[model samples]
Target chain A: MTRPPPRILLVEDTPTQAEVAKALLRDMGLEIRHAETAGRALADALANPPDAILLDLELPDFGGFELMQKLRAEGVEAAIIVVTANASVNTAVEAMRQGAMDFIVKPYAKARLTVTLNNALEKRALTQELKTVKAQLSRDRFFGFIGASAAMQAVYRTIEGVAASRASVFITGESGTGKELAAEAVHKASPRAAKPFVALNCGAIPRDLLESEVFGHVKGAFTGATDNRVGAAKQADGGTLFLDEIGEMPLEMQVKLLRFVQTGSFQPVGASRPEKVDVRFVCATNRDPLAEVEAGRFREDLYYRLYVVPVELPPLRERGTDSVLIARALLATLSREEGKHFRGFSPEAERAIMAYAWPGNVRQLQNVVRNVVVLHDAEVVEPAMLPPMLLRAAIRPTAPHLTPMAAPVVAPVVAAAPVVAAPAMAEPAVAEPVPVQALPVPLPEPIFVPVPPSPPALALPPLPPPLPSVPVIEPLAVMEKRLILAALAETSQDVARAAALLEINPSTVYRKLQAWKTAGEIP
Target chain B: MHALRLQPLGLCHRLGVWVEPKVDRLASRWHHCHVTVLDPSIAGQLAEDLPRADFLLIINTFRDDLARLTQELTAAAATGDHHSFHRAAHSLAGAAAAVGALRLEASARLGMADEASTAPPPPGLSARIATEAQAALAALAALAQGPG
Candidate 1:
């Protein structure tokens, strides 16, 4: 629907002046209302406010400035333009100080009046638009999450839909993608909110102690079991038990966990009888649980039993602008904690924050903001205040090159074909020559250049020695294959021990070996 | 009061002229203006700035204010009251300035010079203002009756 024309209230005591102003306004296709006294103008304005007001300073009842004050006090937000015969600078200043948008000396030209009115109207429109955007931002904030992106909105909706249900919820996301927070939100939104919310990270505990941690052990059950302790299952009797890194739970533990889940009962260590308790299970994993099941590391029955409701959280990279919002919030909080005066990030800093893909998600953003707050003492966070690695990731065009046996890196490789065909340890292909000098820190050029890969010879040195002359760069894929074979030979072909020595996931090692075997690259 | 109010219209009728409604309509349609008439020396500036309809509106308002202030000035002059005469003359000056009546404005300003005096306005000052008012009304009526 089309909006009505702007209404203008003209407050002039003189009949001739009022008639002239009305004619000009009507000619401009505006709705005009005339009042001969300040009292009438105030009453009309308070009753039905117009878009703009043309006020004469000398009124029969009171001064126009006082009327302006009254209008402000009463919250009538019409744009007031002081139209007075007095052209004194003092009068103009006083009128503006009283909140008049503009001062027009009587008998103003048509062009001047038109331009001023249009400017006031445009300012009002911009203010209204800003108010609408703020309102949307506030609405987008749900539970503890601050994001308005479509992906996060869908996650919020899914959580709200499944919160009251009794079905188990399995959340899947990259590390630091707020899975535990999502589980807590589900518990808070459910009828079990008043009960305890127990959380245990399956991967963080030792395999021997994992079973006892889930279901309490009796006193003197074994070494380090001197006291009878209640476990997460009993602690979360009526509430949610959040098991983080469920994919990392050992196969033996998975059998007991599946039995407990099927019966809602568990046999504690050294306890003869079984103890029963009600629990709503919520599990999360950064790894792919289905892939773990296919590899026979996860029980397929337990996976089906717990994967009833799936909540896949979008990574911080996919959540546009949310990184900025989270950074600002973290800055405010971290500054308060550190007794700093930082209010927000500079535009360049915000741009960098938005451009970089946060592989570690909100956790990484929190650490980056905390690092700035603790190190810098300023009111605004500049790009120089950010961590060097974040700055490089943000400014660098392509993703960081990942070694085949190295742990997974979440950077987006723009040149997908080249990344696949090129050697694994090759330097990332520069789409264009970036001006590294523009960066605050002058980094060495060798950091961007390719270094020689470790040799594939079985007699591998502990570390590659610095070359006396320019060393020849080797293919990264060949070096990676040799390193794996060397590690396997040293560990007597034990993939798990080799993976441990390499500090990468055993599943990663297994997958690589299977790929090599299928291609007949290795026997 | 009635005779004073009818004076300008009667003068227009006696001159064998009447303001044409088409001229008022045409002027209203043609001109949408806002003018400042502060300088008394800018004679006929109001005529050039305003359409005939707007000029007539100001003229009518000036005529009414002139009749009321004229009565007040006559009473103050007869009663030897300088304060009332000064007040009436100040308002009459403003009214004259609204329509750019230079001669009437000058006469009213002269009457305002007795603001601090205990005695009444100067002799013949009221007559001077009355004469200027009559001449101004006649001129405004003639302007209104001109061709569109």
Candidate 2:
């Protein structure tokens, strides 16, 4: 049987642009579903769950950023290609930073769109693959290391290959990607596995004290040298020396380090002759040493020396589903540690976890899992149990609840003389709908109802003081507000753009008008 | 009326892996000791020859190129030609492994091996390979910067 082309949800507000985009994508044989409002988009996405989503940055109801956040929160993993007109480097960077798969500026040809979609699809595949690897990694542990991804497996292989050898190994990865785990794994696998696996952060210590910390100091060597102390290099002479963030070390210290690795000899601060020692160097960093060398921050000689055999740890995001896999494992570990009877995440919670773009990687995931276990009471943690920030993110398109503004048909009786009149220019319905009944102040004598008059009315009464002149009254704010309310009512107030069009600056609008609703002036 | 309702407060616990401090400093010093054994001129020789002191570069490179390489391979396979694809795939396979993109490297190797089995390559293979391979190579090249 011949299968139809993949159906794609195109969420755009403008009719003309939507038609054009639909046609462009349709020509490539993709079936398109158009959603003009955020509410409609959310409903359609949830209902059908298209294979891919083509989103507009600017929506009538919500900004694209928040919409993406919402989709992610809902665990919608469909390939999303942001179709945006507001294309700037900052916006692109921000979008990519926000986990957008691919970005294309406005006025792009169908070819460009197709290319971007293809690239996005490929990335999506890799992301899925990584997730699978993570699942595997979560179950296995070699030494103190824990991971299942192919990257981790490779690290495991390298650890096995190098642990028995006396030759040095350099471990590398971004901050928090478990480079230390790799080092420890190697140390545990080595002949000196029984000895202490001493670790160091090169960037943390001051330049002056670094040498003393590594090579030891005699009791009378310096002002702070009150007692004879063995340095890290001396202390770990028979074991493994795990250097972390090694790129941050100063050039002066690099020379002394070179002497130790070359001859396995070092001198105390007060002693003259060199002291013989035996140790293996395992360096790690988030910084690129080669770039540092090219930039003259790191010595090319030092870099070549450490390059002998290298082990690289993949970042959390790249490790794919391993993030969630690891999170689940961590949850179990944490639950046991806290002595809590916490079950895993609820379905909604799981979706939220998978969708979050973890910039801090594993460390961030671990922290979140730990928090969930300790803070919440329920055995199975629901989405609501998550942090407010995350819940806010999950909502995505928070269309502000629009209240029909109750206008005074007449000006206030006790108020000062009427203000100066402005021109009777036609105003667009650009201002958001503020529920009149919710206003803190009393409504005017005559209220402009959202519903249209029985007969087609020609003119509308002038807006009262403080309420700007709105040209059209019938079927404007009231109609949209009613539509949004109906949708929200249907969706149980999830506010995934279906219930209301969340304004960008919602708090301000709600704050100014909140008193009216409470005063019972207008409902 | 906007009700300022505060719900039942729930507690959250956060845990982080504690890293032993200053071990990297000693390690870097010792690391420097090992480098002094090698000839200074050999340090900058091959991009692949450099120390894996910082794997972030490799990760970044894979991030930047993995998609491009995939696209190229798919396009080559679709077009039924793959000389450039073979070359691109081989290089990328090595580069991907170096940075820990096992899936990508595996895919590239598969594609490269497939290309070699054919006596005469298909059409449009070179352009597809060139485009994708160039992108992936450029990204991986940029990763050789420093300790990161």
Candidate 3:
């Protein structure tokens, strides 16, 4: 009975149409129930569950969008097909966005209905399969790169594509989003896997000694160049040169690096002849290079050269349950290496992982899991094993539900299950709800007065006269808030630069940030 | 069950039961001992044209719009002219085909149809009007008895 023909709840107001629909479904060997109005439909759904719903867009009581939201609030997971007369792609997109499984235009024949029903069922099956596969692969890997989540697989695919290519690669994301590890993964997967994959923090090195260190000096290129040494670029000539924090590279050095990437030739500092070197350029930055270009800080041409086949890493907070998936994998890897037997996460630990904003992203996650594994004596890791900062951060409220951002990122991870699984897991999450408290019930009034010659249309809200009312926020507050939020996001909730962005003071941003330290929202 | 064939007349609101004189004439012929169903969306338009007369008719069918219909039916009701309200009830009676008070709906509909033609009332028209008037009076009396 559980796997019987997909049951569809047909919500149509007209009795004649409802009967016809029921007959069609009966022909398909499917079971159906009908409700006449949106209110009645919602009540019926709450009373008796259906596998899927065929909803008429037009109802005498309320619109489809509102009905879908009400259904979602009640936790009905039925696949909904919006049977509508409207054909605009916009309406379709809106319907899909509002959690409709699919949209079918009305006046459809029995054949079209069958096809739609089958496709919806198939997609449901595919989603369950994905979840199963994700659960299986979650116990593998180090860092937060666990599982064969399609998102991760796509990352792996992109890594494979550019790993052997000598062309420079740019990796971009907010800080702690695992840009460096991705570069390393590419290097490890490439033909040069056996060779040394040297990494240099471009932002960490001083400008004066950077060139000499990179190119190898004649023992006197700078104050600290007392001994003759090969620079990172030279050392990595036969391997991969991973430029971490490439966004912080000085403009002048960027020009030089750009030239080297272009010609594969560069002279050592104070050296006469340009030497040919076969090295791959892999760079990463937390900054949006396009924004840096606009600010006249980063070179435009250099940006394009390095940005070829750019890979963007999703931030940790948006990774949904993959946070737990990656954490579990990291725990397994560390446990085996450390010769410890660990079973699984305690309930509290799971809750912490689910709730944390994860501003430091994959790096932070990897560190937290490793720390928990190393410190915990029990067979399972619990909340107490988490860092004090993380433990405290997890309890704070995150503004705006994370579902909208999390669903897309975690979808592929859960989308790899089997062809034979139950399919409800793959449907998109319901859209954000309008505040019920703020909304007022609409009262029907006789607003349409019959005109002399034409049939009456409802009286429209009055149009504004000549000058439009425009409200502008005070410049200082607007700019400060923007800077603070961006800085907090970029630095993974680090208070310092978020303050600097305001330009008024880091101390002020820090003070405000301290008061507003809710988890995940800052990130 | 007895079925009465429908007779169509050109004049509107003819069954005399505290409605327009014309409507009252039409309504009495069909009111009581008949089935009448009204379609609100359609009856709504006609109600607007003869505001005063229609107001009294609405009060008769709905049985609670006395305050508003009193103004429209003042001239008729004051002189014991139940034509306007009768006409309104007759229209409502015609429209209430699916889910309204059946006997009342029938009487009102019959009343409007009878009032439509200028001819003197039909054989059962007078008796039907008296019976319907009693029912309408009882409904109004009950409504007044209930708490607002």
Candidate 4:
């Protein structure tokens, strides 16, 4: 269960808008995949459905509505977040009707993205948890987790042990260790399970807005603060607050956070009165907090405050043949997704999965399985079909001690009946992972039906570019001209009324018009 | 989240788009903007464009616009389009002054004079203007680099 961040598909045409979004969400703990056109976006989504999609309506190949419709039909379940310059209600209503999670306009602040993405990530986490819980086999698993190895067994024990307590739980693991999943497990096992579970990755948001994100901001708090919205801290009141990558938080904000943690009160940015919230804190980070403290990057007092009950997650390489187990699980799920029957992996492929150091953990395994399901039609996945890294890996024997625990789960899954594909269905319960060598039953036939090629493009008017530069005033002069002309025409050439509407002197307007005429700029 | 930003040398802390505020006395009388590097209004507008806009980007944009307008002014003078020359030169003058380049501003204003009062500008004017703009840009680069 190497915890991969939530995967997000970003469909945007303009580089600046994409760049802006990346900067804002870089610290939010989501893995973002950018697609400049609808074709690429569809390809990516079809290959591996993301947890969320930040879609730009105006695309080169198709409209967002068409893409969303296609994705829904194909069982791609990622939440669609509509991002456009025009935040019109009609667009909002249409996008929502087409299944958008939320709508946002351009020139958005760092705080704005934080709120939107946090909600999307939460929905995804909850959905995954729900699916995992509903599946009969998953009943034995903790949340949406599956691992019977000593490492995962220890994690389950820790989450169960701490479930009833109100103590701050700090979970630490390398990049793919399922830290967020573990956090969700903690929330579900706790008394606050019925309440909300709000989480934020301290590393993924802009520093200026991080305070506003955690503590919330008032209207006009900063340049782009157009409305007042509650932050995660307040939103998670009477619930649990999980702060991932707590190590990445700025030191100054750490001081403020320490204060809030000590006394359950905080003031939103630009707010006069402080707020009090009753919430439990569950924080996590990959780096050694003690090292961070020595480096002077992390606050020592804050570390001690948050590191009460630390849960260390194991990396994939150390998890023995769990890669094979996870890969089979992924194959079962993704094969059904692609409607391809990849009954199982070849002996060499199994050996490679067992031997390769899966630096990307379960997420990478999922992708590799996806790669095979997408490109090849064979029932058995050969090592050559695996990623080059897996093929080039030194084939090490599976650790003997870890082999026995996975033996019992392999037979049940293969012997069991094939599961049908349903869009809103819960995840099939994760069986005890069956080691590759322990697999006893013969798998079903390889179905060679490849996915039909995409249909003709659904053309929609492309959105205008975000950065529109004018040769003269660039974008500004045009706006100024429009304002002036609108005022002039509205007043029927009454300079006084037009100037009053514009809050400018009539003489100034007259002078500008005369200058424009002199320069032959206006008729 | 506030702790995660990669700030540059204790300067304009932003989304890795680090830009330090002015270090020299450019906003004073000795320098046209000895109190600030660029006109406060324009600087504010730039910041508005990117509330957390990096100072490095502003410097880069200013440098690019200065070089481009210098070329435009030269081309207008070459074609004997005095009005175009005046427009380009005036535009350059305003932009240069806004960014605190006194020498470049003065040079650009030379092209702003009416054609009726003076002969068309000579070819070397462009070269001189270019040189001044280059020097001004170099100064800004130094300001960005700081003592280090």
Best by DockQ: 1
Question: Model 3: how many Å of interface RMSD?
Answer: 16.2
Docking class of 4: incorrect
Put down candidate 1 lDDT per residue, B27-78, tens digits, no spaces: 2322232122233233255555556666677677767788888999999889
CA shift of A165, model 4, Å:
0.6
Recovered fraction of real interface contacts per model: 0.10, 0.00, 0.00, 0.00
Ranking by lDDT: 1, 4, 3, 2
lDDT of 3 by residue, A1-523 (tens): 1667766788876443454355445556777888878998999889987778888876768977899999999988788899865567998999999999888874455567778887886786677678666754453453325544555656666777787776677888888777888888878877888887889998999987677756667667567657777778788877899998887888988888889888988878867778788888888999888999999989999998888879887776655577788788788888887777887887667756766667677787888887877776568887656654443234322212111221111110112311222234545333342222122221111111122344212111111111111212335444345545654665466454333222234567666556555633443
* Candidate 1 residue spans exceeding 4 A from truth: A1-138, A393-523, B1-148
Which scores better on lDDT, 1 or 3?
Answer: 1
Sort order, TM-score high to low: 1, 2, 4, 3
| Whole-model lDDT values for every prediction | 0.73, 0.59, 0.60, 0.68
Tens digits of per-residue lDDT, candidate 3, B1-148, equal 8886443321222323344344344454544324333322223322332233333343343433322232333343344444564444333342232112334444444444444555433334434434554555454334333334
Candidate 1: residue B138 Cα off by (Å):
77
Which runs in model 2 stand beyond 4 Å of their true positions?
A1-139, A388-523, B1-148
Q: For candidate 2, what is the TM-score?
A: 0.41
| Clashes (candidate 2) | 60
Q: What is the DockQ of each candidate?
A: 0.11, 0.01, 0.01, 0.01
TM-score of each candidate's B chain against the true B chain: 0.66, 0.39, 0.31, 0.60
Query: Candidate 1 i-RMS (Å)?
Result: 3.8
* Model 2 Cα lDDT, one tens digit per residue, A106-221: 53455677777767766766877898767545545666655666777777778888889988898778777888888888888888988878888888988788888888899989
